[model samples]
Each structure stands twice: as C-alpha cells, then as structure tokens.
Target: MSNRMRIGALLGASMAFAFSMAAHAAAPAGGLGATHYNLSSLKSDGHYDRFIVTWRPGSAERANPSLMRQSMGAALSRAGLVRATLSAQGMMQAPVQASYGRRLAIGADVLRTSRKLDRNEAAALMAQIASDPAVLHVAPDVLRHAVRDIAAPASLRPSAFKPSDTEFRQYQWDLKAPSGRATAFGDRNYGGAHVNAAWDLADGKGIVIAVLDTGITTHVDVNTKLAGAGYDFITDAFLSGRKNDGRIPGGWDPGDWTTGRPWQSMCTDEFNPPQPSSWHGTHVASTVGAERTNNGIGLAGIAYRARVLPIRVLGHCGGYDSDISDAIIWAAGGHVDGVPDNTHPAQVINLSLGGYGQCTADDPMGQAIALANKRGAVVVVAAGNDNDNAKYFSPASCPGTVTVAATGITSRRAYYSNYGRTVDLAAPGGGIYAGDRSSGEQVSDGFVWQAINSGATKPVADDSNYAGYAGTSQATPHVSGTVALMQAARLARGLKPLTPAAVLDILQRTAATPKVAPDHRIGAGILDAYAAVNMAINSGGTTSQATLLGNGVALSDLSGAKGSRTVYRIDVPEGAGKLSLRTSGGSGDVTLYVNRGTPATAEDYHCRSAHAGTSESVVLDHPAAGSWFVTVVGRTGYRGVSLVGKYLASR
Candidate 1:
C-alpha cells in the first residue's frame, strides 16, 4: 500500500484527488490536453458528447435566459460550432428554456454540439465561450474513479475453523492481539487497538456510518442489510463502466479495473500502470459495521450492529471531487437534483479513500464537508498513505474531519502513513513490514484483516475469505467504527448528539498516548476504543469522580477561569510501573502539576506545558508511593479542556 504507489494519479491539470491505494491508478500526472486526453480517440460509447458551461454569479445572462441563449448562439456561430442544449444524458435539462438545475454548480448549463466534439474540440468550444465575457468556466464533465488500486489478495493467515468468526477471530489480531489464541505468525503480538474492553461497555447500537467508496460487494462476513439502501453517484456514462446506464439507486461495487491505458488514454501517463479490482468499498464497509458474535461469521467490527449506508461514488477508474462532494451533502440528507432523497441520513460518514491535493474552506470538497458538519454528521477521513505532511491532501487536510493516521503492531506510525497537525488520531493500519518476508516471517497479524472479495480478479471464492491490506485506508475504519460506539453510548446516556468539535475533543481526550515520547506528528495519540466508549457510556451531564489506582483514566471536559483550578487524586501503588498526566481539547494555557500534598496547597513534584493550546503532559519517572494530587492550573481561561491521568503498576 506504500512504496511508489504514492500520489496515484492527478486529475488532469485540475487539483483533484483521484489516486488509488495499491498501485497508482488515477489520471496521469498533468497535461490532460495532450498526453492525458485525446478527444478524437474517445469511443463515445459510454462517454458523453457535451460540455457544461457555468456563468459567474450576478451575471445578467443567468436572469435573462433569452439574452443568454442569443449570446451563446452568437458565440457558437462566430466559432462555427453547431450545438444543441442537452444534459449529458442527451435530453434537455429544461426544454426550450434556460433552467436552474444544480446537477453541476448553480447556474450551469449543459451544451451539446450538433456532432460529438472530441475533448480537444470541447476545449476549443470552452475557450470560445470564455471569450464571451459571461462564462465562468467550461469542462468536459470527465469521469472519475474511486481511490483504490488493483487488488493483490490480502496476506490472510491460514486458520482452521470454517470461514466463520469462530476461526476468523483467532486471526483478527486487530481486536485481541496476544491475548487471543496465538496467530499463524506464532508471535503473541499485543499491539491491537484494544477495542474489546470498550465493546463490553456498549456495542454500537442504532448508529449509521455512511461509507463512500466503491460500494458494497456480496460477502458473508457482513449482513446484506448492512449495505442499507445505497445509491451509485457515478453519473458519467464512460466511468460507470455499466454500458449505458446512468446513476442508479443501489450502492454496489462494479469492479474498478484500470490498465496502463486508462479509459483509452482519457487520462494516462507512462508512469500509471495496470491494476485489478480493489474490492475497496466492501473492505471499508465491513470494517466499520460488520456483524460479530452471531451466526458464527467473520471478525467483529469496532461498532457491532451499527447500520452501514453504502453510497457508491467511485467506479471504473475513480470518482470526481464533484461527485464525492455531492455524496457528503446527500449523505447528510442534503438534496441533489435527479437523485432521490436519502431515506435514512447518516450521522457519521467514513471516507477510507482519498485523492490527490488538499482542500480549503473555499474549495468544492471543503464546502461540502462544512455542509455535512452543519447537518450533524461526523466526517472521518484517511490521512493518505503518502508519508508526507497530511496538510497537503484533500479531506485529510480539510477542516472538520477527524483525520486518522496508520499505526503498526508496535503502536508506531506506519512507514507510509501521512502525519503532522492534520492528523487527529492513530489506529492499527498494521506494519508487519518490520519482518523480512524473505525470511520465514509471514506478514500475518500485521495488516488490517477483514472480509473483501476480489470478484474482478479470479473465479470461485478465490480472494473472498478473510484478507489484510495495509495503509491509512485500513486504519480509518477503526476510528469510524469507534465513533459509532461513542455516539451510541452518548445517546444511551440520554445526552444530546455530540457536535463535531465535541466528538473530536472526546476522541483526543481519551486517546492512548503514544508509546514513544510525545510528538506532534501523529496528532493526539493512538485511538483507545475502550477509553472512548467507556467515557461516552459514563460521561453524563455531571462531574463525577471515581476511585482509580494504577489505572489509566480520563476526566473529560473540564473548564473554568484563569484563577480557577480542578484537582484529581490518584493513589500510586508501591511498585507502580509508570505514572503520567495529560490535558487536551480547547485552546488555553494550562499547566499540569503533580504533588503529594493537599489539593489547594500542593507543591509541584512534576510540571509540563510544552506547547500551549490545550495538550499538556507531565510524567513522574518513579514517584513516591503515596497519595498524590493531579492539579490543572489555568494560565488562561479554560473552555472545556479534558484531563487524563494514568498509573500503571507492575504485577
């Protein structure tokens, strides 16, 4: 999932993220006009032969349709381009009138030439309209593929039981690592995300996670109902790869296979190579809400019983930013023309896939994310497997997303996982690469193992059992699934649905601090599924205190004035292994101090305030075994900061 597949494919010259996960299977890097796309070569079989023209806002042409049509006619006549008005579907968006249809952006009209114009001629026509002084921009309405490369069957460990959970759980190291029965790898690894402890508190109930990917593929690991009423948003006839079908109402994966020659060179470079169907959407869907503890199926998901809503956006090659943007809006129950209303809106949306480039509040993707947030949806995105700073990728870098990075069995960053401030948390993305495959070490128990079928590859149940794939693509669901657990736990406690910021606050506040020394690269820390759900199920609208000795626990949402202070007491055993304290959430100068004295008059035995803005940590390297007070002093006003403390005792 790493190596050179980084930055899969760039969408022509447009700033788009259409790259794949395995090998690079996106539009070639740059130059769509020459090397990327040749209009004359298009088969027009599934490709549409029209262009969309959008006018700038406040343009008189939009309000006066007749004048706009006359101006367009004059431009077409001068350019000698015979054309008709039709949607990409060969029908008028609105017969005999300039209409308001947001299939494209608002105030955009589809222009069909008398005869099909190759992409080059389309570009020429766009240029002609641009000279009219009223046109905003013109585009070919290109097809997009989902962000998944070809599939090479995941390195699943050979297990003994029937292809059910009874056998699969033994290899699902992501949940019960070294504690469960030994894996085929023979190493009792103890580096999973530690989700079972949380599940005991509350298995996800009645939560909906919207998975926007290739769509769901049939598999026994998950309930078919898990695929919930989904819709395919791939509107481009050429990219749908379904002959001449338009957008449909079912969210299903239809093999996304691309050879070195992409879409007849619609967007290909010498660097792009051949890839098989990734079965990506299915892998992601099962990860978020797959059934567990029933019918003897595969491994359990982070959020069991959480309904899955599959919204198919990527197909043949990859999907467009426009399509994904619309999916976000529609998933949150926002309306999209020609597409029916979503009967069941999702509370949380997971995007295991990503494209090239970053998104800002003003960009199309950023705006869509903002809209989703307004509708009370939590958007979790992968921090791309590029190994670069995450701020350079779309959605991952976009605001409001709980950006996730990949971690290995050792709870360290995956070699290829992107990092930096954009990352919000880390999860098991599996990094067995530590072992030399040339040696006897099978990469078992290293990759995120789940149920994914490669029907586009071979015949039979060839690649469908249980498999593993590594990358932030695998880590994202861990966070998304855990989110479902938190939401369920919150509602069960009779609390209102959490806002996006509050959810992020809880996640970071309850996260397991990094095993290594503190660092800003992987965001707050590794996701502690047990910690998050435990707090959710217990954190009511009250300030409750508890007795925890030699146990790592979090005190969520503590806030007050600069002169105010909140104190927590901890009892360290004589031989406690370690002791630590940390603060997170809002932007405020907070100092964490530890002292074995009175709560109000305690002396500082340890103090930490590395960098401001909520996250503060203090460690007492081998402290005195006695009663101690953990105090948070607000150097500035505290607006909902969370404090966590841990005391590990060596048995």
Candidate 2:
C-alpha cells in the first residue's frame, strides 16, 4: 500500500518546544494596515491555511524554535475573530493550534494553522503576524497546481527523418515543424517547437536540466543513466506522501491524486473536481530528455542525451513557495541545510508550477531565482494557466526568469495561458479545443503528448504510458529542453556555458514568428529549437552582448538603471532610402546611438539622439546597408521604454 495521505489530513508537528524566551511583541494598534502583507494575492486565492514567515537575520525567531513558536502563537491569539472584508456572511478566526512546518533554505519558516481560513480571515491573521517587528515577511503558502489540463490525441502526417519512437509520426505533432498542414482535427499542426531539426545538431549531451515539479515516476522513455542525485524537497509528510516528515533522497512522485473526502474538501472548487495523479513531472522530464527515442518504443525528447535532475517540489494539494524556493537553490548547486549538496548542478531549471501572486524582488522565490541565475542556471517558468496577465503570478513574474507562454497547434496563444510582457517566448502547450480558442468543444490531438503512468491514484503495474495534456506547464519544458540542447551544442564547440541572460537573448532572438498574431502579449515569438541551437553553436558565449533585431514590431518595456547600456542590431536591406529608429513611452531619460556595420557606443556612433525622457529617435537617409547597431544608454533609471525600427522605401 502507498503512504499517500489525504490532502490537509496530516496532523501538525508536535509543539513540544519550551516557551520561556521573550518573543517579539505585536505592533501597536493601527500599524498593521501599513505593513506589506500581500493582501491582493490573499484576496485572490480566497482560501489559505498555512503561511510562510521570514524573520530578520539576527532575530531570535530565526535562531530559536521556542521563540519562533511563542511569537507566532501569540500573534495568532491576538488576531482574534473578525468578519470577512469581501463577504459579510463569512467569518474569520485565528487557529487555536498553531505549529511549525519546516525552515526553508532561504531562512523562511513555514507555519501551519489548525484549519483553512477564508482569504479575509487569513489576511487578518497575516496582519497580526506582520505586526511583529522581527517578522520580515509573511505570506500564505499558497498551493500551486500543475499548470496542465488533460485532453485526447490527434492525427498527423510524417515529418522529414521521423524518429523511430512509436508515437512520433502520428501523435507527437508538438515536436514537428510548422507545416501549416490541416490535421484530422480542425486546427493545423503548425505550433511545434521544431525540435526535430535541432536533434540533428545536438542531443543535449553534457547538459543537466532540473525539473522542479511533482517529480518523476518510473518511465521507460525517460533516461536515468546520467541522472543526478535527485531529492524530494517536499518537507510536509502529508504532501510528500512519505512516512517521514523531512526531505528525503530520490525525486519520486508518490502520486498527487486529490481524491475522496478530506482532499476533495480542501483542493476542489466549483469548476475543479478532485483530480487524479497527473504524473506531471514525468511528462515534463520526458519532454526535456526522454532517452528512449529512435528505439521504436515511445516518443522523442527535446534533449535525449542530457541528464534530467528530477527535484520534487509540488505534492498533494499543491506545493508551498518555501519548498519550491529551496528546491530552486538546491537544484542550481546552492547549499541547503540538511540536504546534501547537489553534485550535478543543472544548467537549466524548469519550474512548471506557480501560485497566485506578484513576485517581488524581495520575495523568497524571487531571490532564489536571482541566485540561481547568478549560479549560471537558466530558470524557465510557466506563465501560469490563469489565462490572465502573467505579471500577477509568482516566479512567472519574477525577475531573471525566462517565463514561457503556451501556444496551440495553430500557433495561437493557448486559451488558458497567462500572457503579458513578462513572458519571454511561446511553445507548443497544445490547444485542447477546435479553433484553439476559448469555449469550444474539446478535440483530439489538441494536447502535448508524452509519457505518463496508467494509475489514476498511484503507481500502477505499467509505467510506460503516453497521454496528452495542455498548459504552460507543458510549454515550459519545451524551452528548458531546448536550452539543454543549446548549452550542449555550445559546450561541444569548446565554448563556455551561456549565462542565463545570454540564453534568454539567444532564445528570443532566434524564436520563430507566430503564424497568427497572438490575442494577448505572449513573448518575442514561438521557440525555434534549430535556430536557437545554431545560434548557440556559433556565438562565442556572448549571446546577450549584442542581440539581433528586425522591423514591423517594437521591443516593449525595455528598462535599465542609470549608466546601463543595452545594444541591438538590425540589418538594413540594399537600396533602402531611410533607416528610422525611435524610442518612446515609459519614464526617465535615455540616449539612442546608431552606428553602421559595427556595435554602437556613446563615443563612436554615426548618429545619436539624447532626450530628457524616453522619447528619442535617429533617422539616417540613404543609410548604408549591412548591420546597424543601436544602443540605448540610460541617463536616469528608465522603464517601459519601447524601441521600434522601420526601413522606408527608396525614393
């Protein structure tokens, strides 16, 4: 029998610590409202039972469990009962029994309440907790689910040099190139990441990708030969579905099926019912590097030769940001307490799960991502499945992350994909409907197909199974896996690994333009694995130093602090009369420099435009052909700056 417990069914840890130390007292009355408690996210999730609290570095709460428990319990009692702000009929009460969950790698503590509370009640309790001067930050441990939704399969024609994997030709439309060919379903199979072409160049040798999700189960297609020493980062015993409470070795999915009474009561909503175990990590991991390709068995992986370091973060009823934050750091070779140091540091970290919240620079997950980027790991995150602006989602909106949006087979933004300027690019997340639009009947072959387990609730006899699921969750791995191939190709040429920023630049620069205009702002374009790998092989590990640009669209929301410089290059066609470059919108002062055939700098440029604010332009009549480099130098800290280029017809 499996050790899986129902969601929210596990009892809190023993509160046996002595409470003799003097804890930080609550703030004076009327000061609670002034604190930053993430009220917007709290109001959106609508239900929260557990909260994560980060204490000041030198505070007693960070050093002593007794002091931490005392301070938190006292704050809970002080909050008392209150009426819900959004609903008059709803009541909010503090938990009678409060307990410590686990300390995170980022030095945050997870605190659990006796039961779930409404958003307003949780807000009130959060206000009380934030009132303490020692408390640096406190936010709900909002549960983040797998961003994918299930669907059926579709028919597809053969691509050039099809893999021997049984499902490659017919069902794996996501891996093929955009043929614009009509499928058995209404939509054409044109939204693939074009991984088939990239396969001939690089198979992700010598690269490691970490999948931070529900973890990997047994799969024949997924390669474990070069696997790293993975870990299950889920600290909660109930969530881990293990007997022990603390983290354990081995990143195995013990099943995240939220079925039956208690789990149903906790995880279900009006539109959502109790879900079966998704085997999300398995499918995601396979997409990155399922090695059983060309063996006449399953399906092809984007990076078949690369190592996948499966790190379990999400579990039953979703995972906490605290667990996820630690997982991100650990996967990128950062040290975490108690957990062994990762011997195999991943070059790419894929986060296919996230919760409702804007990720601030100070947020634990945000800091963790920044650190991961500093460690040279490209962090790829899902743009979320909320079908709203990705800026409102954690990690997706986090700085230094390559947030990915979802596209259907027809290359349209998936109906359920979150889109915004935060998204870096789009991938085949599969549209589960007729027209790849919202509110249509579900169709076959509308989901990204990959390996999965047959069991509905837990691991079953057969593990080599394939199914289709759709979401930005599925789209994210396409990018992560492609990054592995790019890095592997770069390394094969004796070049140093591309930095996170460099990787993003290459990806955005080489991405394929969408066949149809996106309904919302997704990103630069659809991921082109071949172009990305080719660019990686050619560039000398300085991909972001000078990015390539084109006309017809503006690069929006460009921002930089004072004295920072960002450069781009656009090729002018022969016989062009004028090359017009413009920068407008947003705030603060900036200068634009244009140079022909070389990188532009302040001292050496053919033309320059300096404005007090963002409005700046440079026009060169009878402009010389070849590469024209445009540089943007910040006079003051600027944001939301849009840069556009246009080549006029010759007179």
Candidate 3:
C-alpha cells in the first residue's frame, strides 16, 4: 500500500490530542456568547448549544416552500431555540436552550445541542450524525483553537558545517588543481575549482536552511560545526536539551531514530524487517555545509562556510501533516506554543522526504509552504526518489517553492530522479558509479563518502560516520548550497538582501544551459556556482542600453513582415534600477517588453507605450543587474513603431 493510504488507515481513526481542561476550561463569566455543538448530549450543561439539521435527499413531503418555512419555525419555537437561519444547503444552525429537552425529528434526524460534550463526546456525536438517515457527516462546531509556539530572537545560525576525514580529502588543496597537480588526494578524482568558487560565496552564512527529517545525532561534525539545536515536534522536546554532555543545548535520544519496523498501520500481514539505518538527515546535512579543511577528515561539503538548523519532523512511519505543518511554520520563523522560540529562522528549508502524490494548489502542505514563503524563507524540496514525472510530490509541488531535480556527475538527469516543468533546476546528486554502496561496485567507482551512522553501537549499525549513497536527496543540498553562495556574494558586495524571487532569478539566470539538447528534465540547466557568484559580484547598480539596429529608423520603413525589429539590450547595474523606451518618430501605439530569452512570454518584463507622439517613453523599474532583451512592437495596427531605449539612472 502507498504511504499515504497506510498512514491514513493507521491515524484516520486516532484522535488528536485533547486540550487540557485545566488550560482551556474557564469559559468567560458571561458564558461563551453562543456555543456550537455537533452532539446532542452537551445541552444539559447550562451552555447554549447549536447543531446542524439537514433535509433528507429526494424526500418528497410536498414541494411547498411555505410548508418548509412553517415547519422549521414550529420546530425552533418548540425546542426553545433562538436565532434560526436557513443555510444554502437547506440546513439550519440554531441556538437552543439546554433546558428544552424536546428533540424535533426531521425525517429520520433530530436537532439538538452538545455543549457538554468534550473531545471524545464530540467524536461519538459525529459517528451518530453519520448514521442518521437525514445527515451526511456532522462536523464539530467547536471553536477551532490555534496552537501557538514561542518565538525566539533571531540569534540562531541558519546553516551548519560537516566534519570528517573524507571531507578533508575532498578539499585538501586548491579545488582547481588538475589531477596530478595536488599531492594529498584520493583516487576518487573531482575538480575543486567549482567547489571553491561555491565556498567563497555562500557557505550558508546568514541563510537559514531547515532539515525536515530524522533528528540529527550528536555527531562530531554537527556538534562542532553549525549545530543549532532544533525542535522535535514529534516528542515535543528540544533536541538539543536531550544532550548528555549539556555542552550542546539538546541531548541525544535513541528514540529519535524512528526508521525501520512494519508500517505504522495495523496491518497484520504486512510484516517487513526494518530498513538499515541510512542516517539520511546527517548525510544530507554534510553535503550542504560540512566543515572544510579541519585537518584530516572525510568528504568536503558544497558550502563549507554555511550553518545548519536541524528541524526533525519525520520519524516512525514518516510524519503527520499536522506535525509537518507545524515544523514548516516554525522553521520559517513563525511562533509555535510549547516549543521554544526559533531564534534563528531559516532562510531556506530543505525537504528531502516526500511520499508518492501529485501536486495540487489547494493541498494543505502547499498552503503551509505558501506561509513559509510569505515569511521570507526559500523552500527547496527534492523532486522525489522515484523516477517519474506524472507524479509531483508535496512540498516540492507547492507554489513558491524551488523544486530541484537530480543530475549525475556527467550533467545528465539521474535515472531515479523525478522530472517535469515543476522542476526548477538540476544539481549533481551522485549516482551509482559516483560513490561506494552495498551493490559491490568497485571502491573507486561506487558511491563513497563520509557516511553518517557508520560507526554506531546501539542499533549496532546506527553509528554516525560517512558512506556514499545515491539519490535526489544528495542533489538537493548542492543547489541549497549554491543559493547560500549567491546570498553570501550579494552580502559581500554590499547589495541589499535578496528576496526569494531575486534568489530564484539569480539561480536561473546564472545556470549553465545544458550542452546537450535541452529537455524538460533539466529545467534551465546544470547549476553553475562560479557563474552565479560572478553575476552577483559584477552586477553593477545601473541600467545600460543596447542597440538592436543602427541608431536611425523610419516608421514606414519597418512596415513589411520583413521589417527588422531592433534587439536593444539593457544592462541593469548593481542594485535596483529602471529601464525605459522612447522613440524620436512613431505613428500608431508602441509597446515595449523585456525578456531574458527569445520569444518572451507574459512572465517577462513589459510596459505600455507612453503616447503616440515622438520622443514618447515608457519605463520599467527595479530591474535586476543582468542581460535583458527589450522588444518594441506596433500596437495600433500600424505598420511599425520606432523607438530609442535608454537606462534611466537610479538615485
């Protein structure tokens, strides 16, 4: 069975935690203005209650509107109910006094109050309502309470660094060295120039990336590096607080490891041994920000300077929507009650875990992600480990999120990675031959790296160390790290901080287009850390103009289908600036649009003509520093539009 179906079967019948009566017991002295109940038992507790009464479907008791109105009014008056209103679905939500025990039966259903019913009582009431012939499913009219968590000051590190011998081997010398140029190197050859370029900028400083997976262990790399103790939404304990040494705020707990065992559902025949510990979160963490050059160690991270804020949301049978939602909100820097404040909110959230499901705009998880973006956090999610495009998984499919697909070392999409238009970019997530795995592939060829839980004792195989595995999970961090590099470069240049949109722009614009034919699998192209950083640094804060044709033109001369449209290039300098188009001579309406590529769509930059007169101009503002194409088109059915474009200087 699918994970969702399994989880639904297991938890669908389970009740959400009840509010502590000691905490929420006190009703205002004046009483709750009007108590809404889904049950009939609560009416006797001196609290006014209201229940929904629906009409039976296809029940013909004479189709008289007057009769229906009179019947409802009589029932309300007899039940001592007040404020009765007819609903669009022919249902009524009326406030009735508890003393009136008269239960008026409509067809086979009765309307009553349930103010005395608690959480359990309400559930039973719903069950009863479901059984009623006149009712479909009765929803609790209880006041929906918002669960709040504490908010901390912004002092938490947004990124983290990994430490190990393998990492040291990867960064021992200048990453640019060609093969024999370096001495302390492993046979596993890799070009370091790109890695170094990435490190110089992002190292994840200032950007908050939340790891929504298994809780991180007290591994050496994590503890010494960017160890920002995150919350454990599952156990309701601060992970750092569980630390035995007390040096780190949260301590380690074995129960935190919730992988393996039968599915969370109660299926008796579905027995399967626990999968071996992957230490998935730790490995993912190292890739993004493993510490660099820490003497002798394991593989190096993509962004050595970045920090990590571990937010553990997945555990036993994956995680629940409620918990994941809370984690997303808190990780994005929103307040949650009970949990300590997230002092350092994440600027980027990395979600490597996803079940099989297609993406929808209205999905609850999608809504939560939208909230995260609104709070200024860029969410990056794996496309999925399954190699399919028809199914786009959650969190990744959510709007405003940067969905990442996986590419192999050769710049080809990985065989196991999902792909589609929803995918924003591709990154090098190591494949089979890239590292060592249990598949018996040669040491030099199989996936090999600093494996987490490599030396564990408890589960015996759960030790934290390095090992190489291949999946889109590994590829996501590469992009996350690049984003950090872009952000860091922007910060160094004294440029204003980037919004999520700006970051997306930089990533897409600077990406290296695939040398092979472009495919839907690889969106823009492979991630180019060096190019991205260069763009951010060299992008000056002004606008410059480009000439498409020689600086002379006549309206009638451009009349034919062969009439050439000049390609004016406008360069936006560093910082924010505006670009405008104007012409010395033109007849009909003129329109101007800006695009990054040929055949720009509505997503590109555009502005209407200022007027029909000569020297008329239209301006586009806040253009980022980059190469853009401005096209002038005749709008008034006129043969041609003549124009001169210039970059308006910014103050």
Question: What lDDT tens digits, residue by residue, belong to model 3 across residues 501-581?
Answer: 656655655555443443446555566677666665544333334455322232333331211233466555665466655
Report lDDT (Cα) of residue 122, candidate 3: 35
The parts of candidate 1 lying over 4 Å away from their true place are 1-156, 159-161, 177-184, 188-190, 226-228, 259-271, 291-293, 435-442, 457-464, 517-520, 544-651
Which predicted model would earn the best lDDT? 2
Top TM-score model: 2
**Candidate 2 at 71: error in angstroms?**
3.3
lDDT of 2 by residue, 471-513 (tens): 7888999999999999999788787888886687668666777
Cα error, candidate 2, residue 234 (Å) = 1.4
Off by over 4 Å in 2: 1-36, 81-98, 153-166, 181-187, 226-228, 439-441, 541-651
Q: Which of the predicted structures, 2 or 3, would earn the higher TM-score when compared with the native?
A: 2
TM-score of 1: 0.67
What C-alpha lDDT does candidate 2 achieve relative to the native structure? Answer: 0.75
Per-residue C-alpha lDDT of model 1 across residues 1-651, encoded as one tens digit per residue: 011111122111112222322212222233123321222212212333454555667888756656566765665565555534565568643212122223443335555444545433454554566667776555444343333321223234333325565544565667653243455566455457778777776677878889988887776566557454889987766666776746888887766666533563664444344455667777777777764445566666778788888988876666766677788888988887878888878889998766444455544566678888998899998887666667656668788899998776666676667788888888877764543121244366667766666453321232345556767877888898888888888777776777776577557656665554333388767787887677565443322353333356676667876434566778777987678878889766566656674442112234444344678887777777877776665545677777777877868
Q: Estimate each model's TM-score.
A: 0.67, 0.76, 0.56
Range of the 10 consecutive residues with the lowest summed lDDT in candidate 3: 1-10
